[model samples]
Target chain A: MKIKLCLQKSTPRKYLFHFIADDRAWIDLLLSKVALIFVSIIILAALYHLAADAGRMNHDRQLDLIAQDFCSAINSAGKSSYETAGGNIYFFDAYNKYGNFGSGINASVSGEYVSVSFEENGRRYGSVKPLMYKTLPLSEDEVRGELMGAFSANGNISQPIPAFYGYTAVTEFLAALGTKEENLNTSMEVHIEKTLIYIHNLNGTEVKELEYILVHQ
Target chain B: MSTSLFISDEKAFMEPHNDIISTAMIVIGFVIFAAILSKTYLTYDDNSLSLENYRQAALIANDVVGYPAIQGSRQDLISAYALDSITMPAADREMHSDFFQRFSSNADFFVDVRTDDGSHAWIIDRYEASSHDGDIIAASVPVVIELGNNARCVPGTVTVRLRKNKWI
Candidate 1:
């Protein structure tokens, strides 16, 4: 009995096949893929760290510039003539390059340094600049009373006093003496005294003399 | 024939190691690029700081030439009498200190006043060479020097040299 012979054509496989010579080759492929992913993760992490460091450096530079600018303004005012009226005003705005306001921007004077600090990404950054001369911080009341006394002695109470002591009303004085809050913006008034002003310390024990006064305006 | 040709094509198969090697090379290149970029940025920052120091020196020079205490009979003039008092071998320490107080305390600098004819020269607040280890930025301004005794005015230059310190 002769069986009927039949010829059939096989269709080509649509998907490509990768032949693994051995289990070791399979393990090698798997390990290499894992290593590539690990390396990519490491590269990404490194890039992230580098970017963060650069951002921190930029923020530090901004703080430094703010301190330097405030210090320079103080020095400039100190060098001006004592007879110059209406001391110069320095406006400090803690605005970043992106035009967004910085958080917790504050400036203060302690010892011989003017320090400006701000917060970024939950981190606090600060910079300090040395003052050209001895400086004292005075309140509105103290400044006004001192000016009134000085002007009265000079027999020029009606005339405006030189170096930011000329305002007659408290409102005008406060306007010139800007807020001292730790906000996005502030102003400082720098003035030189015609004569040395003696002040008693907080304890009213030690006397300190100041020729330059930095007021929050 | 087509299947044979496709299988024989060189691009049909790639070694897995090549992927990792290429990725590593790319990462290395990126790192190098980043290093160079940071280096350039730091250089730019340093250059800008130096420029600022030079500007500060220039301002100090201008201010020194116009100082009320050292000014001659006219504006923008330096008095020989005042210069002598300030720069004499036994200069008054108090007066020198007072004069320097007019400038920023943070600035480490000195001034040199001299006549164009080399008749007179004075160094104000001369700092020792070893005191600072940095570049010196100098700015000069022309002024009229009045000889108090002879009642004569001569051309002079005031040079202000600022030591570039990290703090400033």
Candidate 2:
């Protein structure tokens, strides 16, 4: 009887072992759910980032187009039209004559800061006390240095011009600027009448200079 | 009586085995759940370089140029006025005012008038202005000068600010 019982047990246990009920169904289910959540979050985040990048690129493209349009106007106007109010050139006038800024980019303008200087005449009779202007987010050193050189230098300030940051729009005009020329016939005066215009780009990375001389023909 | 006692003992042993197996399954299930959660939470990629490049480009677009008009000095017009002073020069004054209006309409800016002693005063002016973009760093101011009687001159302090409006 003992030998027969051992043989039966061997066959029965082998079949049961092959079909054991130790399945990890619950563990696999939970792990899959958690993994799905993580992957979803990463996908969503990437999507958001891509959308933001697209918007920024669009904005930059618009600004670039506007800058180009402004440059064209300044160049065509012969620089003299822009030199009103020292260096202030009215955008309204430009627009009225040539339609709105071609790029359709919108911006608000405001004063950033102010400066004043006293100057003694150089080989001229009268002394001049001048007022200087600047936009916001600019350092004192940069503003002063550029103005000082521009005041003393001859035609068109030299290269390596100062760079500017911040501010949406910038303009310049001449309250008063003059030059004296002496000739063999007699002492001649070459007055630089009218205002000079400077248009600063939205990024402040570029400035368009417009020169204006009174038509003394 | 002996057979009845054997059956009762077998029942008690079977109950304990069932309890042990159930408890082990519950613990393993919880461990798997926890590992999955951690793997999802711990993964992240960095894109700081791209962010920095975009920021720099925006700054350049906003601050490439300086307002040269506001850079001029605003001192008393007595000396130059007296020398070239034509009594009742309303025409010239009107022309000058018109010029100023043209400059004023271009953009908004502050005009700082500084004295020799380093004491400074500023004026706020507005122009019809727009920007490509502006940033905190790489902003600058432009100073423009309008010479008097063609007499060379210099200002004490001149600076312009490029204000960048930040989103985010």
At residue B78, candidate 1 shows an lDDT of: 82
Provide the TM-score for each candidate, comma-separated: 0.67, 0.27
* Candidate 2 deviant stretches above 4 angstroms: A1-34, A37-217, B1-99, B104-106, B119-155, B160-168
Q: Model 1 chain B: which ten-residue window has the lowest total lDDT? A: B125-134
Candidate 1 lDDT, tens digit per residue, A151-172? 4322133333343332233223
lDDT of each: 0.62, 0.32
A86-144: candidate 2 lDDT, tens digit per residue: 32232422334323223222322113211111112321111111111212211223333
List RMSD in Å for every model shown: 11.8, 22.7
List-wise, what DockQ does each model earn? 0.20, 0.02
Q: How many residue pairs clash in each candidate?
A: 3, 89
Instruction: Give the Å error, residue A88, model 2.
Output: 18
RMSD in angstroms between candidate 1 and the native structure over all alpha carbons: 11.8
For model 2, report DockQ: 0.02
What does chain B score (TM) in every candidate?
0.75, 0.24
Quote the B-chain TM-score, candidate 1: 0.75
